[model samples]
Target: MLSWALTFLIIAIIAAVFGFGGIAGAAAGIAKIIFFIFVVLLVISLVANAVKGKAPKV
Candidate 1:
């Protein structure tokens, strides 16, 4: 999910450089949503692991 966000961010930058305002805006918006979702999921996973009182399997 994070990688997808990064991919979209790169796309946005390239699009912006090429003067594609619409595409850049859309990609950036998608990247933002994905990034936030990733962060939220990560936090939830961490809390779940802590509450379980066990180390994550490597």
Candidate 2:
């Protein structure tokens, strides 16, 4: 999930360097959405682990 966002971000950067405005914008948008989803899931996982009284595995 986070990797996917990073991949999209890289793609956006590359596209922008090549002057692909539409592609860059679309990829950047997708990256942002994926990043937020990853953040939400991470928070939820942490809360679940805390509720179970288990430390998150390192």
Best by TM-score: 1
Clashes per candidate (backbone, < 3 Å): 0, 0
Q: How good is model 1 by TM-score? A: 0.91
Q: What is the TM-score of each candidate against the true structure?
A: 0.91, 0.91
Q: Model 2: what TM-score? A: 0.91
Q: Among all windows of ten consecutive residues in candidate 2, which has the lowest summed lDDT?
A: 47-56
Candidate 2 Cα errors over 4 Å, as ranges: 54-58
Which residue ranges in model 1 land beyond 4 Å of their true spot?
Answer: 55-58
Q: How close is each model in CA RMSD to the real structure?
A: 4.0, 4.5
